[model samples]
Target: MSVEGGAGEPLSDSQKREIAVWFLTNAPAGEIHYVAKDVRALLGDDAVYEAAAAEAFPEYNKAHLVSLELPDRSGDIIIATYGELDRNNYLDPRTAQVATVDHIKQTCTKLRPAADEELPSAYIEEFRSALDVELSKYVAEAYPKGVCAVYCTSGKDIEGPGADFGFAVVISAAKRSPQNFCNGSWRSIWTMDFNYELQFVDIKGKIQVDAHYFEEGNVQLDTNIDCKDSTIMQSPDDCAVSITNIIRHHESEYLSSLEESYLNLSDATFKDLRRKLPVTRTLFPWHNTLAFSLTRDLAKELALGK
Candidate 1:
């Protein structure tokens, strides 16, 4: 297909050749992303889809920016490292809003709140009966006021491996406050590649969350929290003590299994890629209410096959 030129001057043949070369040589595998903003502005979405199917650019999913047609493009085409769009000229919400709000609404309809959804009923009954007490005891001793309640929640793992086999327990705070006090969680998930995250969340602040995971056998420990909380503001240092408290409180078979999963991996290559690497990730916080509504939509868009 002879793709038409962009609204403004589309990337020239030389520019396209240079971008493709740069991507091959320098860009990490499968990191290149292309949006339809330029072609869509010039022609329309129909044309953009045609372009998306082209071999020159495979597709990236759920980028929030590249959901469907990028809202607008300052320049017709983009070719850069990961998150280049969100970097300079394209950072404005008006410029890079993900597929419309209606697009998200239509997709998330009839969807139970992610927070409300429980792991398949059988799992919830078992988890509550087995581990709730230990979790509550741990939380109570760890923080002032401790935990008021703990409940199970179900969600698919966004990365790592497949759908979770069980529910995650939400440790609710005894002294709840709108601004400061927030809940915490101990989530054990997976069938084959078992993984768990013990997280502290500030529901009052948008995207206020901190997570910790100790790879089995104390081989590794990863902290996955939004850096904006402490790293950016330079307030409290990374809360290693919180993680110590969470794990120190509960010593259970379930938590042990999660540790084993992380510990006993056969893939030397994958292990090399993961050895002792502290995983501090940026938070994609969308309140407990929004949960996975938009994520589900973007997964559908990219055909991520969940």
Candidate 2:
């Protein structure tokens, strides 16, 4: 609550507000606790940890910086930094340098090398090109009017074994300009949204993966590849090609259902707001509405009555 212990002065009102906004925008919605360095990176301010951690004590590893109670009253956000503890559960390894090394040691697995050591950068680019060609063809045949974009990734960070093979396809279509239909000036819209993300990870002796047709929410899958030759690291091209084929097959099978869902959302959900528009169905001059009176009385008459 109060700054002390030479960390620095208390955070200004602007500083507190910035910290809260930065945390909400950048940090994951499901997580509240964050380390000081993570806060520094997310906020893009190097001095945050010291100023915010001024209130922290040596006995506690977690240095509470910003405390915010949610508007919905579900819970609060306690933005803090947790110092690394040793095997005896003591906060001996408190510096950022030690924490960085510990993180590397934990996440850099044998099968998944560091980002720099993974397959050549050129190979990753090639993999991306292959995915784009194949996915673009599928999108063209499936949704002729829809705009498709592909993002390919093939690297591991200090967090986990990044996906050996991974890509995301985003399809956006059904543009609508509802300047007049909606209540306010922000009535412009584009209703259709469909995204597909696929990733494969090699764990132990098995290739953990699973296949699904279509899902409304985020979906993660796992499958077991028992064949030793299927390891992606050993045969990158063959594995990539095999994954692309699998994606094409799944997209072909379930894309129609996804389209149907989008159609239903547009027809049933969008129709409600569409019908409520002015009979002209044209852009309403909402800015001019302030000139009219709701009580159906002259201004003088209303004043006299009041």
Candidate 3:
């Protein structure tokens, strides 16, 4: 497009060539459209190509001024008061108001080189390595079975290899804790991957013991039947057996309880739980009430007989 103005002059072939070269070398990618508009306006259609010529052969107009359109969608354009026609003439938002050689130098300092450093990709790789190390440590300490499964979760439940491992740990742990007679009891295992990804396993079961009683009038009685109470002493073997039985008998209940609990958590509370879980650092940064609600539900389910 050409701009209409007085003192119109036909642009020389040399000037047109210069303007094209300046745009190819200095304009940001996909930004030449606005640059062309601005250059056409300042030089008028007749001498619009002069801007390009001027950029190539600075000797043409050492004191010539050029206009540039801002990349923002605000439709704002700026005129370069004085400078060689090149990227150096580009005005940055920071020094736009104060026009000076020094300001141009400062803007140049803020411009990024066109080379890609792959920073984001490198960061993600490092984070993943660290997460793997951490998960290995947890597996060694808690799940000697070598983390049979693992899962990853974010804004919503995500099923994967990582999540499967986490579920296994939950089942194993549930088979080890004491049960509650009033309801049930549970223990949860959680892991955080790098970038704040979270993984969790829920273990739920009941513990049973026998009750003893003494009659007041010339009679004493003790019941050997299994009862859900902490008052009676039971061997470790018996405890383990009770836990395994509870897990097998109430597997569906355990899952259902977790689902119900998550449903009850408010959005804010769920976020807090995700933050509080130590596993967040190893997992991607995703927080929601669903995770918290699940944990709460497991706690309630375990407390059933308590």
Best by TM-score: 2
State the lDDT at 193 in candidate 2: 14
Assess each prediction's global lDDT (C-alpha) against the native: 0.27, 0.30, 0.30
lDDT of 2 at 206: 17
- Model 3 clash number: 39
Please provide the root mean square deviation of candidate 2 (C-alpha atoms, Å): 20.9
C-alpha lDDT of residue 173 in model 1 = 19
Give the TM-score of each candidate: 0.20, 0.26, 0.15
The positional error of residue 183 in candidate 3, measured at the CA in angstroms, is: 17
**lDDT: which is higher, 1 or 3?**
3
Sequence-dependent TM-score of model 3: 0.15
Better of 1 and 2 by TM-score: 2
Give the distance in Å from residue 221's predicted Cα in candidate 1 to where it truly belongs. 23
For each of the candidates, the C-alpha root-mean-square deviation to the true structure, in angstroms, is: 20.4, 20.9, 30.5
Q: Write the per-residue lDDT of candidate 3 for residues 133-242, one digit (tens) a residue.
A: 44334333432222211222221222223222211112122111112111111222223222222322233223221111111111111111112211111232342333
Tens-digit lDDT track of model 2 for 51-90: 4433322212122112223233332222223212332111
Model 2, stretches more than 4 Å misplaced? 1-120, 156-166, 177-245, 252-255, 258-306
Stretches of model 3 off by over 4 angstroms after superposition: 1-122, 146-306
Candidate 1 regions off by >4 Å? 1-35, 42-107, 112-119, 125-306
